[model samples]
Target: IKQLDSLKIDLSKTAPKKENLYFKNGVLYKKGILFAKGIEKGRVLDQFLKKINFKPKSVIFIDDKLKYLDEVEKFCKKLKIKFLGLRYGYLDKKVNNLQGFICDIQHKNLKKIFCFIQLNRNGYFQIVIYFKNNKLSMLIF
Candidate 1:
């Protein structure tokens, strides 16, 4: 906590108390949690394929990893290659570890729609992002 006070950086506006300060290896930490959270696995998958200049049917990259199958399905059908060892979990560990950033901040309380990590009748985590214009966006981490 002393380290964060010295660095002069806010961890997350929403989670100022819980995430305001973290000691990384007994050192100071001042990175925004939302900045990292927003780039989570699903989001990263979206960004990853977008970066490859591949747009689904327009282009496809075959891989043995199956967890990303959903991401590929967004723009393509399926590849002949088999997806063997793949895990479903956090993709952006660096940002995911940042657990207190404001993915959305509202001047006044507004309705937010969060997403769940797994497919269940009862959801796990909820995500809601609100902008300045009273508009709301949903994201799952």
Candidate 2:
């Protein structure tokens, strides 16, 4: 929530307090949102379903891992709920490309082109690149 606030994104109009967000069997919930940290995706979905008053006509589950997608797919099948599972890989590819770019820069001209390179606390790469004319280019991701 603090992170969102830092970016000027306000949720105060509908935001629940930290205290309102509770945990049940390792799953975190705040009103309708669920954060299934360190828990099986299928079990989390089941718990969420039980909490809702009305059954959903369809569910669309997207995850970076195929294992989690499979788990949710099986659960939806057992419940006779229409489900679509999407295995998201776009970010994975982007991260891979970024890593390759970092490696290429380091191997080719680290001292000449790079002013600074850092891996921040959030695991994001912060790079300061210098052009031939001493122009600056900063990349953060």
Candidate 3:
């Protein structure tokens, strides 16, 4: 909350009255504010639209979890709202250390290993593994 508080601009004269912002609160509100149990349900979009009393031409839902993105995508498709799913990426020195871990695991367990890597898509490293007859067959993610 301190970080968010720092970003607030004192636009007292320039502020628009119709514009309102609501941050996620873990408590229930009985009056004006809309609350949700979680993001994965995709109900927040509906609540927001209802609160504004407007049907937008498009909606963008950003989430780090692929499962939540998938859920929101489904809802957006049903509502004919243009949707884009974005995976949040952490590009830190820690990611470089992950390369060594990947190599160590491959050397210890797998045979005929191959990896195809590309740059800067989401700044995330994901490993997808496939197994055939309880043996590791493919790894690509």
Which 10-residue window in model 2 sums to the lowest lDDT? 12-21
Give the best candidate by lDDT.
Answer: 2
Worst 10 residues of 1 by lDDT: 32-41
How far in Å is the alpha carbon of 85 misplaced in model 3? Answer: 1.7
Error of 1 at 125 (Å): 6.5
Measured against the true structure, the TM-scores of the candidates, in listed sequence, are 0.22, 0.54, 0.43
Which ranking of candidates, highest TM-score first?
2, 3, 1
- For residues 25-128, write the lDDT of model 3, one tens digit per residue: 44232233333545434667565666556666665655556777787778788888888787665544456555556566556656544443433244355553
Give lDDT: candidate 1, residue 98.
41
* Per-candidate clash tally: 4, 0, 0
Q: What are the per-residue Cα lDDT tens digits for candidate 1 across 1-141? A: 334659876544533233333332222223433122312233443443453343333433332235344554443444332223344545445334645443334223344433223322222343444443556554544
Against the correct fold, how does model 2 do in TM-score?
0.54
Tens-digit lDDT string for candidate 2 (12-97):
44433323345557677653355777578888878766764346677888877788899988988998989999987866755565
- In terms of lDDT, model 3 sits at 0.54
Q: Where in model 1 is the C-alpha error above 4 Å?
A: 1-83, 88-90, 102-126, 129-131, 138-141
Give the 10-residue window scoring lowest on summed lDDT in candidate 3. Answer: 26-35
The CA lDDT at 39 in model 3 is 47
